[model samples]
Target chain A: MADASYPDGLLYHPEHDWAQIDGETATFGITWFAQDALGEVVFFDPPQVGVQVTQGESYAEVESVKAVSDVIAPLSGEIVEVNADLADAPERINDDPYGEGWMVKVKLADAGEQQGLMDAAAYQAQLG
Target chain B: MVAAPSDTLRRTALFDRHVAAGARLVPFAGWEMPVQYAGVRAEHLAVRARAGVFDVSHMGEVETRGPGALAFLQRMLSNDVSQIAVGGAQYSVLCREDGGVLDDLFTYRLADDRFLTVTNAANHAKDLAWLRAHADGFDVQLADRLDDYAMLAVQGPAARELLAPLADGPLPARFHTAELTVAGVPALVCGTGYTGEDGVELLCAPAGAPAIWDAVLAAGVVPAGLAARDTLRLEACFHLYGNDLMESRGPIEAGLGWCCKEATGFVGAEAVAAARAAGPAERLVPFAFTGPGIPRQGNAVVGGGEVTSGTLSPCLGVGVGMAYVPAERAVVATEIEIDVRGKVRPAVVADKPLYRKAA
Candidate 1:
C-alpha cells in the first residue's frame, strides 16, 4: 500500500531519470514520477557496474505491465554500482523509488552536471 | 523541434481534434492512436460516472451485403448471428483455423441480407484479407468499409441523455440501431459499447463524425481517450484482442467458451471442439494483489502457470490484474503471487472484469 507517487531527495530529468550525489559518485534511478507513468514495473535491464554513461544518455530499459520504457542516466559518469536488487524487485522503484529503487551509482566525470538537472520541485512543476 | 519519424500510423478523421486536445498519441495497431487525453484513471472514472465520447473510427468496418450475407456471417462468427435480428448488433469473434481467435468483433445486421462487421482497428487489414480469403464462392460480397465511415462511442450512464438530442430518439435499446441525424450529420446509432455500460456507438460519414462528436460534447459528453477506453474495458472484464486473446490462445483458455456455439460449423469450429474435448492447458482469470506492489503485463505468474495481460486496477484500491494460470489456480479465491520486481507478492484469483457497473 505504499504510494507510487513522486518522492523528494532526488533530482529528476524530464524523461524520469534521477540523480543522487555523494561526493564525485552519483547514484541514479528512475523517479517516482516516471514509475507512476510506467504503471507497474516488472522488469529492469540494467547496465554493467563498470559501464561508462553520459549525462542524459539512456543506459537501461524498464518494462512495465503495459510497455517497455528506457531508463536514462542523469550525469556523465562511470557506473560504480548497478542496483542488482532491481533485477528482481523492480517495483522498488514504485514502492520507495528515491530510497531502495536507486538503479545505479556513477563516478561522475563532472560534479557540475548536477546543476543542469531539475530539482524535485522543478521536476514536479514540469509535470504540471 | 524535429518531429518523430512518420511511421505508417493510420489515423482517424478526428486525429487533429485529439492532438488539439493535447492527447498523448501512440502507435496502436499501425495507427497513431491516443493513449490518454488527460490521464488513464481520470478519464476512466469520467466514463464510469459521466458521459464520455471515444473516436473508435480506427476499428474496421466490413460489410457483408448481397443475398447470402447473414448465412455467410453465421458460419464466420462464433456467436449466433441469426439471433441478431435486423437493426440489432451482436458481439462475436472471428476464429482461426485452429479455433483460435483472430479478432473479437461486432456484427450489425443492417438489413435482411446486409450486415456490418466492426473489427479491431489494428486488425482491419488482416481481418479483411482473412475474410476475403475465406469468403470465396459464398454468393456474399465483402467490402471493407474502413474508409467510408467514422465510429464514435458515447458511453456511461448519462450517455443517453447526452446523445438523445443529437439522435432521432433514445438509444436503440441494447444492440438495436436507429437511423438518426446528429448535428445535422446523418448517422447510425447502436446501443452497444465495449465499456460494459449503457452506451451507443454512432457510425457516420468520416467528416460528419466530428460534428456529431462536438455536438455530443456540447451536450455534456466528455471527450475520453484511449487510456480511459482501456481501463474501462479492463474493469468491465471485457477481453482485449491482442492482449487477452490472440492466435496463440482460444476461447476456452480465455474463459470465453460461452460464446462458442456447438450447433454452428464456423471456421475453427473443429479446432475449438477438439480443444474443448482435450481441455485447455491454461485459463484466463483475474488476480488482485494482497501485498504492496502492483502486478503488470508479462510479469511472471507464480502458483498458477503462465501470465497474460496484467495492470494496476486503480478502482480496486490494490494491484489487480489478469493471467493465464492452470485451471486449478484460476479458481475464484485461489491464492497466488504475481512476480513483481522479482518479489512474489501474494494475490487472490477473482472473476474476470473486476469492476462491473451494471449493464
Candidate 2:
C-alpha cells in the first residue's frame, strides 16, 4: 500500500474520498487513510457509467477480506467512466490509491459543490 | 458499531507485545485482543505455508483432579473419559440436558487422576458455573485456572522445528502432552492446535509468556492474530463455538457426532442420541462461492438456512464458509444461493477442509 499522503492537488471529503478535479470532470478515489484502515482490498464493486451520484452519498462499494465499505461520493456528478481494471485486481486501491486505483470519472452535476469539500491540508488537519 | 469502554475489557499477558507489533486491537469476548498484525491474509497464509504463533491467553481452563475425576468428567463431557490414557488429549463438547452445545473443549490428561479442560474465552464463566452447579454428587475437585496460565499456539508446517531447538526434551506427538522446559520456562506442551496444522499449544505461567513468545518469534514464527485464526480454522471446517456450535445447536447437526459417545450417558447424551436416530433437520456444511462477492455471518440462504461464519479463504482465493442448511440440500455440490446484504451470491456445497496440502 502507498504511504500516507494527501496530495495538495486533490480536494478531499470528510468521508475520506479525493477528487482530482480537471475542469468539468474529476477522477474519484478513496484517500490513503481510508485504504489503510480497510486493509487489503479484495473486491471493488463499481457504480455504472451514466448513473448520477449525489455528494455525501454512497455510490459504490469496496470490500476487503474481512469487511465491506461504502465508497461515498465527494461531489455530485454523473459517472462518465468506471475503472474496469479493478474488477480483476482490487488491491490497486491500496497500492496506488490516487493513480491506477481511481474508481470513477465524474462530470460535475454542480461545480459549486466543490466549495463544501476540503483542501488536502484541511483534510489532513481534520484527520488529527 | 460502538464497542464497550476499553477499561471494562480484559488484557492478556502478551498485550504489550501485540501493541509493539502494531496489531489492530479490537474487543472480542470481553477482552481487548489483537485482530490482525501486518495483515490477515498475510498472517493466514504464513501459517499454512510456514509457521505462526498466536497468543491464546484469553481462553480459560478448568483443572479436574482427585479419585473421582474420570467418573465426573465422563458425566460432564460428551466424549468417553475412559478412552483417554495418561498424557493424552481428547476433544469433546460440553452440552446442556437438551442436547444443545454449551461449549466445545479439549481436555488433556496429565496423569491418571488429573485433567485440564480448556474452554473458549467467551464461554468460560458460564461453563465453570455450570460445572460447579453439577458437581453435587461427584467427589472430584474443580479449579478455575483462567488466571493461572497464559497460552500460546505455535502452528504450521515448520512449527515443530522452531520449538524443537528451544525445548530441553522432545516435543509431544499429536494427541499427547508432556511437561517440558521450553525457553527456560516450565510449560505443558500439548501437540494440538485448531489451525489444522502440525503444532504445539503451550500453557505456562502468565509471566513466562514473553520469553516463550520471543523465542518462537526469533525462530522465525510470524505473529498471527484472531482474524487469521478465524480464517484458518474455517478453512479446516472446525466448529467455532459461538458461530457454529451454539447452545441451541446439537452435536449431531453440527457434524460432531463422532466425538460423542452415547454409552457415556453424559448430560445431553440422550437427546444427542435421539437426534442421531431420527436425523437432524438442518446440517452444517462448508461451501465456496463460484464467482465474485463474499458471504458474511447473518446472511440468509436463498431457500432456507443461514450463514453462521464466512470469510474469503486465502488459500482457495474464493469466498468460503459454513452454513446450516436443510438436510436434503446439504449434499456436496448442491447448488445454494446466499443473500449477502441485498445481493444474492451463488455457491456450492464443498468438501470439508477446503484447503489441503499436496501429498
Candidate 3:
C-alpha cells in the first residue's frame, strides 16, 4: 500500500472522498485515508455510467476480505465513465488512491456544490 | 454499530504487545483484540505456509472436577465422554434440551477426575450458567477459570517446531495434553488447533503469557490476529458460534452430528436422535464462488437458505463460505446462487474443506 498523502489541487468531502474539478466535469475517488482504513480493497462495485448520483449518498460499494463498505458520493452528477480496470484489480484503490484508483467521471449537476467542499489543508484539519 | 468506550473494553495480557507490534485493535466480544497485525491475507498465508501465533486469552475456560466429572460431562456434552482417556482432548457441543447448540467446545481430560472445557468468549457466561444448572444432580465441582489462565494458539506446519525448542519437555501428541515449562514458565500445552494444520494451544499463567508470546515470535512465528483466525477457520470448514452454530440450529443441521452420540444420553440426545432419523430441514455445507464477487454473511440463497460465514480465501484466491441450504441441496457440486445485497452471485457446494494443501 502507498504512504498516506493527499495531493493538493483537489476538493475533499468530509466522507473521505475527493474530486478533481475541471469546469463542469469532475473525477472522483476515495482519499488515501479512506483506502487505508478499508485495507487492501479486494472488490470494487462501480455504478453504471449513465446513472445519476446524489451528493452525500452511497453510489458504489467496496469490499475487503473481512468487510464491505459503501462508497459515498462527494457531489451530485451523471456518471460519464468508470475505472473499468478496477474490475480485475481492485487493490489499485490502496496502491494508488488518487490516480489509477479513480472511480468515476461525472458531468456535474451543479459545480456550485464544490463551494461546500474543503481544500486539501482544510480537509486535513477537519480530520484532526 | 456503536463503538464501545475503550476504557470499558477488557484487555488481554498481551494487549501492550499487540499495540507495540502495530496491530489494529478492535472491540470483539467485549474485549480489545487485535483484528490484524500486518494484514489479514499476509497473516493467513503465514499460518498456511509456516507458523503463526494468536493471543486467545479472551476465550473462557471451565474446570470440572470431583469423582463425578466423567459422568457429569457425559450428560452435559454431546460426545461420548468415556472414550476420552486422561490427557486426551475431545470436541463436542453444549446443547439445549431442544437440540439448539449453546456452544461448540473442546474438553481436555486433565486427570482421572478432572477436565478443562474451553468456551467461546461471548458465550462463556451463558455456558457456565447452563453447566452449573445441570450440576445439581451430579457430584461434580464447577469452577470458572476464565481469568485464571491465558491462552495462546500457535498453528501451522511448523508450529510444533517453533515451540519444541523453548519447551522443557516433549510436546503432547494430537488430541492430547502435557504439562511443561515453556520459556521458563509452567504451561499446559495441548496438541490441538483450529487452523487445519498441526499446532499446539498453550495455557499458562496470565503473567507468563508475554514470555511465551515473545519466545514464539522470536522463533519466527507471525503474529496473526482475529481476522486471519476467522479466515483460516472458515477455510477449514470449522463452524463459528454466532455465524454457523446458533440456538435456531441444531448440531445435526450444522453437519456436526459426528460428535453427537445419542446413546450417551447427553442433554439433547433425544432431540438429536430425532433430527438424525427424520433429517434436518436445512443442512450446512461449504461452498466457493463459481465466478466473480465475494459472498458475505446474511446473503440470501437464491431459492432457499442463508449464508452463515463467507470470505475471500487467501489460499484459493476466491470467495468461499458455509451456508444452510435445503437438505437436498447439500450435495457436493450442487449449484446455487447467492444474493450478495442485490447482485446474484453463483456458487457451488464443495467438499468439507475449501482449501487443502497439495499432497
Per-residue CA lDDT of model 2 for B228-284, tens digit only, reads: 999999999998998998999999999999999989999999999999999999999
DockQ in order: 0.15, 0.50, 0.53
lDDT of 1 by residue, B1-359 (tens): 11253657788888888888777777777778777775566677788888788988888899999877877887888888889898998888889988888999888888998998898987888888998888777889999899999999999989998778766655689979888887889888888998867899989999887788778878987788776787677767788888888988888888887888847888888888887888888889877777656566678887646556566565665667778998766689988877865768888888766886555
Ranked candidates, highest DockQ first = 3, 2, 1
TM-score of chain B of 3: 0.99
Worst 10 residues of 3 chain B by lDDT: B1-10
Comparing 1 with 2 on DockQ, the higher-scoring candidate is 2
TM-score on alpha carbons, each prediction: 0.80, 0.97, 0.98
**What digit string (tens of lDDT, one per residue) describes model 3 on residues A11-126?**
99999999999888999999988898888788898999999999999999999988898988899999999999999889889989999999999999987898999999999998
Best by TM-score: 3
Q: Can you give the lDDT of residue B23 in candidate 2?
A: 88
True contacts kept of 3: 0.44
| Candidate 1 accuracy as lDDT | 0.80
Give the winner by DockQ. 3
- In order, candidate lDDTs are 0.80, 0.94, 0.94
In what order do the candidates fall by TM-score, top score first? 3, 2, 1
Supply candidate 2's per-residue lDDT for B79. Answer: 98
